[model samples]
Target: MSNSLTVGVVQQPAWPDKARSLAASEAGIRAAVSQGAQLVLLQELHATHYFCQYEDPALFDLAEPLDGPTGQRLAELAKELNIVLVGSLFEKRAAGLYHNTAVVYDRAKGRVGQYRKMHIPDDPAFYEKFYFTPGDADDERGQGFTPIDTSVGRLGVLVCWDQWYPEAARLMALSGAELLLYPTAIGWDPNDDDAEKARQKDAWTIIQRSHGVANGLPVLVANRVGFEPDHSGVGGGIAFWGGSFVCGPQGEMLAHAGEETQQLVVNIDMARSENTRRIWPYLRDRRIDAYGDLTRRYRD
Candidate 1:
């Protein structure tokens, strides 16, 4: 595999309509491809605004099957652009069973792999647990940190909340993922103080960056920007801090997007992970035999 690949992260506002949102995303993906992005990653729930703000049964209708229209559309796009595409969607498996899933389309081989969001968060505005079922424990369908093999490399792709857990990152690395990619939709409550917002966003970015350093791989986080309204139609809802960035193996920022704008492309040398790991060698010195405590829910 080549050590360098150009990737693009699309950070744009979502429209209320699904068709319009899909069109906008397609346009963004095409534009990224035009700029020479071999792999394109979109923000979480890119086809719609963060609709988990409420627990209405009506919202469940938004969920579509993996082979449904949405996925098919993206597959067509992948074939058209001849670029690998990573997309997140609200998937409807069966009646009353839904999941927050990410699909990776390999341009060379077509639809190849997918990973469901494992860690569901039930925060005030982000009521994900009520909607998505946690991924099944069995690895039959390539769940968990099993990286998807593509033309570029094995991609350790995970959703927003999963990025917070070190176990997820470790498992992906153990499975031989060359890079970690997070398709995220995170932000701060409008009512929070600016200082608090800054702290929260900074902490979020730093945690993911640390994942790169700890596992000796690059980390890419694609977050949504702009504000969406709350369920109660109140004032401004979560203002998605759009600091989508790419961090090198040593936790150095390779590329970053602004807080309130749409960034098209960010290029990086994928081979940097190998050189950084050769110098730092954290993976070479792991004490695996002493990590039994990690399996326990809590060490009393």
Candidate 2:
């Protein structure tokens, strides 16, 4: 594999209409390709609005099977552009079974692999637990946290809420993942004060960057932008602060985007992960024998 990898992120606002939302994603993908990005990532649920803000049974209709229209389009785009692409979807696995899933496509190989969002969030405005069944512990081919193999590299794909967990990132790194990628849609309540909003955004950024520093791998995050109103009227709408970014092996920012629809393209030095790990060998010095309590629900 090449020592350098050019990656891109599409931070775009979504719409209720799938066609319009997909158009925006396609435009961003094309722009990224024009800039010579070999791999591209789209924000979570780029096909529709943040409907998880409120739970309604009728909204289940939004879910589609694994080979749904959205997935097919993403595969076609990967083939057309000859680039590795990552996209998110609402997957309808079976009757009343659904998940927040991320799919990967590699050039002409079509759909290569996928990862289901493991950590489902149920906060006030984010009610993912109601709409999604937590991903199974093991996919047919491998374990839940297994990295997906692609032409670009081994991508440790995780979804929105999964980004917050250190164990998830560590497991991916342990499984020999070359990079960590997050398809996220996290935002703040518009009513929050400026200070609170800043804190929330900063915390989100820091934790994800820390994942890179801890694992000695590059990190790529694609977050949605714009204000999405809570049509259910249960609370104020979420203003998605689209600070999508890419960071290198040592937690250095390569490229970042503000709160707007933007495409970020950056070159990641793939060899840096190996070099950094040589100097700061966190993985080599891990106390694997004494960490049996990690599987417990609580120490108490």
Candidate 3:
């Protein structure tokens, strides 16, 4: 593992057309590589628009197998650029099952590992529960919440909704993850007022930054931008607030992008995690024995 790592986060708008969406993603990847980024991350569901805005059986057609064309394209990009890449996909695990999955590709190594989104949200506009099945808790290799080992570093990659959970970050850190990453597709309802939008965006940003401060690891977030209208017309469309960013171990902003199609290339000092943890020591003071109630759905 190197003492420093150069990373990239691509935040772009998406369309229902897969070809057009991927072209945008590829352009961002190329731009990042030109700036010496060794690892790159694309936002969640970059291959298509936010289809989960409404539940329709037809949307299942949007999903592909793990080694399908989208995955292959991402793997090829990783090899072509000689960089480790993280990309999100809507996976068709089986006939009646699907998942929001994140895939990792190492240069020349092909598809290395994957993490299925564990938290499925069911809200008015973001109806993810109708589409995705949560990841298994314990697989043969202990997959859930496990960090993926890569040439760049051990990556603790989680999807959008997972970012709101501290347990997920803590588990990844406990398993030797060096950095935390979120490939997210979160936005606000267009009908919301400006004050409400600000509150929502601020809360989202603060929660993720707090994850970095608590875990003593860098956090990388890539979120889509632009307004994506709900085709079903059941609700007002979402205006994706594209405030993609990179923060250091101390929750200090390294780089931040505005609400536009942008790619951020930032150098992360890997040594900071060790130095920060040594002084903060949040991990060492954990009262694990007294936290057994966390497993229950509710304590009442």
Candidates' lDDT values, in order? 0.86, 0.94, 0.96
User: What order do candidates take by TM-score, descending?
Assistant: 3, 2, 1
Name every residue pair that clashes in candidate 3: none
Candidate 3 lDDT by residue in tens digits, 1-300 = 999899999999999999999999999999999999999999999999999999899999999999999999999999999999999999999999999999999999999999999999999899999999999986875469999999999999999999999999999999999999999999998888999999999999999999999999999999999999999988898999999999999999999999999999999999999999999999999999899999999989
Candidate 2, overall lDDT? Answer: 0.94
Residue 72, candidate 3: alpha-carbon lDDT: 99
lDDT of 3 at 132: 98
Off by over 4 Å in 3: none
Q: What is the TM-score of candidate 2?
A: 0.99
Q: Name the runs in model 2 displaced over 4 angstroms.
A: none
User: Can you write out model 2's per-residue Cα lDDT over 221-297, one digit (the tens) per residue?
Assistant: 99999999998888899999999999998999999999999999999889999999999999989999999999999
> Where in model 1 is the C-alpha error above 4 Å?
234-236
> How far off is model 3, as Cα RMSD?
0.7
Candidate 1: which pairs clash? none
